[model samples]
Target chain A: MSMFPIIMWILMVVVAFVIYIPVAIKINKTGLKRLGATAHIFTCDPDKDPIK
Target chain B: MSIYLGVFIGYFAIIIISSIVGAKKVETMGDFTTGGNSMGLILGVGTSVATWLSVASVMGVPGNIYSRGVCAITGWIAGWFGGTALMPLIAYKIRRPAVPTRTFPEFIHARYDADKDVSPLQIVAAVIELAGYFVFSFIQVQGFGIVLNRITGLPFVTCCWLFMIILVFTCFGGFQSVARTDTVNAILILIGVIAGAITVVNVAGGMGAIVENFATTTAPAVTGGNPIPAGSLTSTWGVFGASAIMSTFLSNSLGASVAPHWVARFMAPKNAKTGALQMFWVVIFLIPIFICIVIIGMGGKALMPSLPEGVTSDYMFPQLIINYLNPVLGSLALVAICAAAVSTANSMLLHCSTSLIYDIVRNIKFSGGKKATVEDDAKTTKVLRITILVLGVLAVIGAIQQWSFLADGFTYVYGAFGSVFFAMVWLGLYVKKMNRPAAWVSLIVGFILYFYCVTQGAPFGLPTFIVSGGCSVISAIIVMLVTKAPPVECYEAYFSDDPSEATVAAMHRIRRDDV
Candidate 1:
């Protein structure tokens, strides 16, 4: 209920978002499109599969 | 009883509702295992954080801080946080494999599959994973039982069974259900930590008083028959001393990257970047929660010097909520505590069961020269549910017997997972020479060394993880050089030189090269 505790909680949020959001966004925009292709399901012949 | 009943019923209702909602999205084995590999950043991060913050994070770390010192944060909490930093080393590489694998062991099976058949090494790895996760799940139930026993005055075994039933029912819908419910648990855990911290801070007469007390308060001369050195609260080494703390830090720092439950989360992300980026959000959300737990542990120590004789320090966190906060809020916090345990327990159980059915059983069926059929989606789902039920029952039986082997030595199970898989998986991703023989040798050496060190009481205060993991990696490298290297196709299928489409294609071309 005190202003100090409320201030502490808000500061934690603000600091974390300020640091994280930008990096996340940049990665999403530039890094994601490229990584998306790599993450696509790789089709393979069943007999050639190492684990099959 | 009324407040607790209402809180628990409400919690179960939310979990069931999420299960029903998520069940609609699960139509295939992939969906059942990895949520259809369509999880966006938010859901992926939410579930990751929730699953990672097991009872160890919620109760064990705080209890350690309460009894030992702030170094518990450095050793246990900070170590876990640091583990996420290592995730990028394998995240995109593992996620971008030429083919998607359902379980961590399946990835190992696919990557190190000798002779294009189910590798014996893969089956051994699955067995280890199943055993590790079974103990992990058992501890969750054990933690839950301890709290419920204290609160309800019920026998511990009864409480264990009660939680076992609830956890199994909640996870019956499998990964989708677990993910949706975990998202909810993640939110509640955040709220609970904040609420608990605020209450503790206010009770301790604000942050200034708490800090002053922590700075000035001497650790009790005797804690549960163990002598506590003076001024451990602020000391860097604290009661456990530097070598033990450092060892724990090194071992736990790899916990997230190698643990089967956490590894499964990487497979669910919508894209490679999402898998990599999820670590950032998990750490961001965890930072405040980490700060709050530090306050609770330190602040509680400042206020309540010691528990009555016979009560373990593990009771510190739950007792704070039960005694200090308002009944309604206390009950909510209790739900969060139970949520923490159940959220993690469900995920581990799911991973363990998947390893049993899809990873081990299916491989056996295929190896028996049984002709492979198109896996019937409905049958797979039914078999998976049955597996979940069976594993849950086994976990309940294990939970009833107090395994001091695991419960007392908190770091051993985690150390085993890290020691066994840390070098093998990470090295296998980048080094084309990492063959199945080397992996097998590494795993065997790691297991023997860790258990031998642990049985010898981790002689000279060196941590089991470093000793085992070091020996394992060294032996693996030596073995890889002596044995024939795996064909280039093994490397091509599992890794890309870089996270680019062109590189992926190049890798695949080599993967498909004529034998």
Candidate 2:
């Protein structure tokens, strides 16, 4: 009944899409490379090639 | 009655089948504890979302809204969303290490005190996890009993005992079993909550009617209670006022982000990307589920002006199903509550047992100069199963007593977790100079302050977490500034993208099973 709950709920959805999705995408793209360079675990994406 | 029993048996069969399948995979300690750290995206999202829903989200949120009005959204829903949104960052860092830590305390041990066989810090971390997850498991069991009692017309104590069977069966097979069943539970929960919401909306005579009832109805939440103030249910602050709402928001959002179970979820995924992506998808998936939950809660208030004498608002969702919905739909909704309870209970029980066996008992054994091997891992896995059974019994006992409002029980533990682990986990990951002394001081300060505030009341009517968490962060920073930098091995696995061979070896030594 209060517009407040509805408004806040929408804001939550917006935060998830705008913030979480991009961060996840960035991590997926570059996280392994960053780790491999320093940790030397894998040069390529482990998701694509099984962890060996 | 027959329809309810038939659907319930069918649901149990599916869950038991999944558990049996999951049991086949538990060949080693790693497999049991972290699903061999190989969970794919769908399973990852399913388990995470299922665990996130819990009984609190399904039952307590609606109950809170029914009693407190729309303000319940500020703390539980919005705060949880905010917490989940931040998990990708934590997940990225946690899953990045080459040889990932199997448990959250193991990560803490590797990050802060890798040089030692078993640091006091590891023991302390494990203790906190043990206590937290034990209470968490108890809450889930209590939730399950409440719903089952309503459905079957069983005594409350009997209902609590009935849940232990499901809890043990789901948890005995370990993480993989829990994950598999959780996926099933998540799908059911989605369908059940949505169906219930649609019915609630319809029964309440459309959204406009519901809103009008909420805004204008002079109904008390309980029989003989004072009538609700006009427009209070429609106000932004509602009856809870701003301070309570803000307090709830802080504890739920900030506390949940670093909760041990969530941290372990990051470790269960195969890689950093999967870990991060799983959470992203979980956030998206939960949006609709939570929206429907809001409708169910607010709509319940609209339909039932006040509950009968001595009835708690915690019964709102179940009562709605029984009185308003037909048998088939009602059974489905009740099963969904079962799913929510089982999914979370199994996960929490797993965490509880692992913290006891892997973190505390094995840590002590290994520290005493016993090296870990594959055989030892098998032995440990057996011990973990036994621990689950033992803890399940204890939780059943605790759950027999209706402790508090289901959601409020979570807030207390979340407040403790947020205060104690917030600074230690966040700073330990990002801050290179975060040494053992800082970590120790921060944890103690946070724990003491949180409990003190809880018992003596927080200053300025602020949430206990804000006061305790603030002090903890300040203390950690101050100590870190003065203390010597942590050893290279302690910091490298988390901070250095390319840790040296020695650092890698040290990390491997931290979890000899990985080696």
Candidate 3:
């Protein structure tokens, strides 16, 4: 692979990993809200979300 | 005219369909504003990539490539890369403390509790931000006109009017519609780019032939002969050392670190991790499109080997498309150009309306408390819609003003804001100490400095972006440090180890609303 490709890939992975942890803790603690009825990915109903 | 209209209508139909799909259930303020933040990784990444791949992506950028060679292009990618890289650091990791704000300046206000007396100051900063987006949107109007006339042989004014009407409808659907529209537009752009690249290279014989022709042609003593021919970026840094090269890199990082549309992407993402994932996707998908454009650029260089009189080197792509490329694919590329112009301009329009509605109209009187009364919230939404209408009208006026001067008027006016924002955005975010006094100082100083640089022959043939970026960053950082003001809780989050993990947990905990 070219230098640019290698650089962009490593940058993407490392940065994604770096940003992953704190967000996990925040979501785990307070829970989260689904975007809407169609929100397929991440939605913790406010009523049932942890602590609340 | 009919062919041009056919290409335009096809492109417009795809985007409008997506917008209408997204706008179906957007009933609330949040939904209206952020598409309820539910975009998938592909859509998010595609749209962001597409947004970056504006007229600049094809015509503006590769022109820089052909003229400066590979190194100059890489020099630019360094800054563009900086803007992308900083997303997780500046925004994703440090978002919670900022989640409540509506606009970019709101993030500024939330970050620093500057004196309440300086409300006008914040509005001035916003106006400064609008300057770039406005220039950008108007340029897209010209871009649409150029492609329409060039490809299908339509009247320029007719093309400009259609471009304006399409933008107003695309924007009227708000963020949700805009997102979906951008996704389709991005896809169309990618398809066109790939096809155009393939067709051009094949039609021109082959890559080796293209490069050889470029090297052998016209002006002697140019890169292998021609001045603006297909050489590389060996000269600009030919005499300058490693430090000079690094300075170019830092300037882009600094400049892109603060673009309004980029930061606005922060609010547009589904969640923190999704945002990060989206950034990765953008990088992955975008490389090919850029490579394709550069290939076409090389093909153009190979074909003309030199521009005709009264035409700049940038016209190479358009000239080639009109003369070469299979008719069907060339027509599709023309349509994709429209998509590129519309996608970028629509984002600018979205931000302009948001700024007007949230910052200007939302406040009746902030004499006491920072937040407004419930009644204040009631009318803000309608006001935003009205602002959208007014902005649409103004954009149409700007589009109509595309007289003999063509793009020069728009570029000069709009480029002003990009300089200012790129200068101060980071300090305003990470360096909490930058207060109202410093913010104002950096803004004014950066604006004048940028104008001066652009006006005064742009110095080293380098873009005004570098000078303006350096001055803005320096002014913003220096003032913040002098005052020793750090935004409350700013340091803790910015320096934290893992930011998106919290959202990942929320991702797991989420329940389908069924609403």
DockQ of each: 0.09, 0.32, 0.11
Better of 2 and 3 by TM-score: 2
Error of 3 at B89 (Å): 1.7
Scanning candidate 2 chain B in windows of ten residues, the lowest lDDT window is: B506-515
Runs of candidate 3 exceeding 4 Å displacement: A1-52, B1-7, B66-72, B114-118, B219-252, B364-379, B399-419, B422-424, B457-478, B481-515
How many residue pairs in model 1 have overlapping backbones? 0
Report the candidate with higher lDDT, 1 versus 3.
1
Q: Which structure is stronger by TM-score: 1 or 2?
A: 2
Ranking by TM-score: 2, 1, 3
State every prediction's TM-score relative to the real structure: 0.86, 0.95, 0.78
TM-score of 2: 0.95
List runs of model 1 lying over 4 Å from the truth.
Answer: A1-34, A37-52, B218-227, B368-377, B404-410, B458-461, B497-515
Model 2 Cα lDDT, one tens digit per residue, B1-515: 89999999999999999999998998888889999888877899899999999999999999998888888888899888878877877887898787889898998898888889877787888889999988889889998898888888999889988899999999989999999999999999998998899999988999888877878877899989999888888788888777778778888888998898999889988777677767778888998898889889889988888988887888899999989988998888899999999999999999999998998888888875467988888889999999999999999999988777899989889889999999888998888899899888889999999999989988988877889999999999999999889889998887655779988888778786545
| Candidate 3 TM-score over all chains jointly | 0.78
Top model number, lDDT: 2
True contacts kept of each: 0.11, 0.47, 0.05
C-alpha lDDT of all candidate models, in order? 0.72, 0.86, 0.59
i-RMSD of model 2 (Å, 1 decimal): 5.5
